[model samples]
Target chain A: MFGLETGFGEFFTNYQYPVMIIIGLTLIYLGIAKKMEPLLLVPIGLGVILVNLPWPGEGLMAYEVLNSSTGLLETIPYQDYVQPPYNMAGGEPVGLMSRIFHYGLSWEIMPPLIFLGLGALTDFGPVIANPKTLLLGAGAQFGVYFAMIVAFGLGAAGLGWFDFQMGEAASIGIIGGADGPTTIFVTNRLAPTILGATAVAAYSYMALVPIIQPPIIKLFTSKKQRQIYMKPQLRAVSNREKIIFPLMATIIIILLVPASAPLVGSFMLGNLLLVSGVTDRLSITAGGGFMNVLTILLGVAVGAQMSGFIFLQQKTLGIFALGLVAFMAATAFGVILAQIMNLFSKTKINPMIGAAGVSAVPMASRVVQRMGQKENPRNFLLMHAMGPNIAGVIGTAVAAGVFISMIG
Target chain B: MAEEIIEAPMVGKIIEVMAKVGEKIAEGDVVCTLESMKMENPLVSPIDGTVKEIKVAAGDTVQAGAEIAVIE
Candidate 1:
């Protein structure tokens, strides 16, 4: 249908697709050259490219789908899919990624499975040995609520030029947790429309943990506070204790926050497999084999959701900016809470370890360790930092539960 | 000579056994590695001593406080 009369030149009219392709290339470059969460980034980067391509073909991303009733193959109209009538349920997926995304993400299957793998790989001993770190985890969750209010304020006041509803606000707020799966799970449930932008913001900030946390932690802590030493050796936890922990934690979390049960349940089940000592094959598969495969699928599916028209909105930029604020606020709250804890306690805790409670797991904890070592060479805070680090995972999940319960 | 019994700190399968009968070892030397919670935790010698006996082999499951080795 494209002769001079039909104007094939209209294909090149909107140049945003080219700009999005360059953005995709930048993400791939960052993953490969910068080594920034490459496991998630590489697949997501490729998906961005696939979804941005303008030309349509069979099995290609953005492929033409047959309108079943009319029996005519039609291109995906951005207007049809961008707003409330997503047509996800009605349309047949014409691309591989579209099919995967339809079944995996929209169905809400991927995030919980990823959490299961994370649980199998996690060590809860550090958290158990130091229960007080649970407060640091809880304290860090302040960022989520704080960001929610900020987003609400922006939308209500019309200052930030974005109108986020309650669900979208709650979803945007979760970026502070620094736990990608929990963020995805909450966003998927609460704000499916903004999932792509929010997921990208959450993961990007997580990858930038090493860069983002140090300055914030340093700003809040003095040299003397940073140099505080924590004992490397943790009291040995018994097998019976380890065996009972997952069940106990699950029961307590479910009883207290029923909404959090899905995420906490998946995570604790994985930990149970690891700690039970009877499920070796299951543990190995959950931690190693299955986890790797799921990461690729989750990354690609999430990336594919970010089609140029949907992702290039002014609201997406607002979400990214607010997401950074939430992250910084979460880190600040964790450290400040630790400093407050020092006032009442006899055995001093390193305030720097408090910063690890942002739930990026070992990355945030490692930053604390490095910062502690810089201030006091003899200070070994890695083990201590892990206590709050793991607790932050639970804290973020609980926070997501709270949001879901109140808002969703 | 006095004998000391080194016990398992947690219930886990032994993935590695570094202790040997009649081998002299320093304090803090790892005697074996245990797999627990998906992490490999090493059981270290509490005191410098000569390894008198190893009670478990690699792949053996042991409970907390179960004797792993006897050092003299």
Candidate 2:
């Protein structure tokens, strides 16, 4: 229903549409030109602008649509009025993105779906080949605690000016783990209040991986260690072993901490598709169009919620700053753990791959391989990096569960 | 025995082919190159074998774990 503006006739008369256009264009450029996390960030940035532009008495650039059965008008969020008089007379309780957020991520639903995609894409062979990497993943989780303690101490010392108790701070810190679904899972459970902030931090840091991880990696590892060559392990793992892994993991993790079942269960579902090989079609759906659609809705909806009023607060900035430190701490701890393991073993380890223990999966592994190739072109770290890469996923999920259980 | 196929492990336009059909090669020898996520990954043969067939050649787009050639 088109309703009359009772007041503020002059306030919104001046349309600052240029700002929204520029912001949207900038994000598009970053996503396309700079090759940032184009899949998610680009959509999110565009969504931010899409919702910001003041639509003309309508929900952000949307037109009214008729409901097939009821023949009712569905006004957009930018719609001046959702309902006027008739039988029901209130506004559409929530806007477009708000409704999406409420429906998708609010109940910790979207994350499990994302995890299903992640599991389908992941290869657990390396992890099964080398179980020791599991310890390194556990070690990398130190960052979550480091950030948690630091956050608590900051709040106590009046440093953050951000409103966060230990529980909320712990959720924010797990972004350093670099596993998006688990981050969503943990944050949703521990601090649903800061879902938007925590999600932005998790994804932003995940995108900045190449930028944030390299310096931390170089700062810690010596050239000698960097130059260490890793002999590729070509041992053929049987399909039986690969298939059993996710199953066993699901049981072990869920039995130990039922809180992690969503993360673990979704992951296993995806892995089962790949290992079983009968669901190639299902795998494609999860790994392709399904993931992309959900990612767009989820990212845009999350971005819309992060308006200036909430994002510009001092606490948000502190959380961002703390997130970087926490990531570095986790990366360093992962490497040190590998080094400790190497000292006791006869076979030498490529410590560079240790950085992948933060659980960014392919990206973290790629960073290790890049550094390895930089020093020794012949050394292929993908097989080796996969060891910790996958182990990190499980470790982070478990850690997320522990944090949520303790805090919530 | 059936030959095993060596695949390009990343998605990218194939940059080069170091081996040809019927060429004798060892394990760890690069068979082809591919670019993905702004990086290159070489398709390598894990077992010492003779090149039997080349499924893809230079300048072709290949995806992760896609068969590029066969080694026997």
Clashes of each: 0, 7
Question: What lDDT tens digits, residue by residue, belong to model 2 across residues A1-408?
Answer: 277643235325534344444655776787889887788768877776666555431143233444444757665442222223222233232556656765687667888888899888888877777888788888888877888788778877776465578877887779879877777777767766466577777877888888888888888788988888766544567899988998999999999988888888998999899888789999888988888888988878766655433445678777877777778888988888888888999887877778899988778988888788767655677778878878888888888888877877
lDDT per model vs. reference: 0.82, 0.74
lDDT of 1 by residue, A1-408 (tens): 353243224336766567777878888888999998899888888888777766541134443455555766665743234444243446666678877777787777888788899999888887888889989988898988899899988998886446888888888888999988888889988888788889889989999999999999989998888877676567877888888989999999999999998889999999999999999899889989898998999998888777777788899999999999999999999999999999999999999888888899888987886677567654557778888999999999999999999988
For model 1, how many clashes? 0
Instruction: Show model 1 residue runs off by greater than 4 Å.
Output: A1-11, A57-79, A84-92, B1-72
Q: List the residue pairs that clash in candidate 1.
A: none
Q: What DockQ does each listed candidate score?
A: 0.06, 0.10
lDDT of 2: 0.74
Q: For each prediction, how big is the interface RMSD?
A: 7.1, 5.2
